[model samples]
Target: MAGPYWFARNIRAGYVGRDRYGKGVMPIAWQGRAVIAGFVAAMIGGGATMFLLFFYAHQMALGVVIYVILVIGGAGTFIWAVATRSDPDKSLAVYLAERQRARSTGR
Candidate 1:
């Protein structure tokens, strides 16, 4: 739902197509791919945590352990993603250039 909206918004915002020079200079595909991948990964992670919590309903201590592990793992991933995130605009520019070159060369 949100993904479609964003894809459309990016396309409308001149982030997915070419300009007067007939050159493709948008990193729309990269952005969309990243967004979808992140969304799916998050959903899976959350679902696994929920399943674990419910599966060990009788064992409260075990449930607590599962929740703790989930929290720690989620926190670690979040921190790593933030710590390693590249400059968005610069990365977009580079992606767009590479895409354009690939298109021109028919690759």
Candidate 2:
């Protein structure tokens, strides 16, 4: 899935893995869980949505309901993962900031 594909797309631009790289490495379980939840939820929910919309074009409301369910369910999973994560989201923000600073400073 593109979610997993992009989630694993290493921001480490040096043609190699860096321990400090955020996008490629899953140093934390919570983060991995979040990614998994999003991908799996999207796959299942999106497939269901498409199936309904394709087969039951007459039932537009049903498709909308399915999409809403997917959104809520997927959000629930993500919230749970994030709530359990010991590392705060700020860590990632800080990391990206440092990376950007490094690149700008030509380190």
On lDDT, the leading prediction is: 2
lDDT per residue (tens digit) for residues 1-107 in model 2: 11211122224334433453554333233456566668587768766886779687866677777777777677676555544543422344445566688789998
Global Cα RMSD, each model: 10.1, 11.8
What TM value does model 1 have? 0.39
lDDT of predicted model 1: 0.47
lDDT of 1 by residue, 1-107 (tens): 12221222112233443331222222244454564456457656766766776676655566556666656665565444433442323334444566688889998
The alpha-carbon lDDT assigned to residue 93 of candidate 1 equals 41
* Candidate 1 least-lDDT 10 residues: 1-10
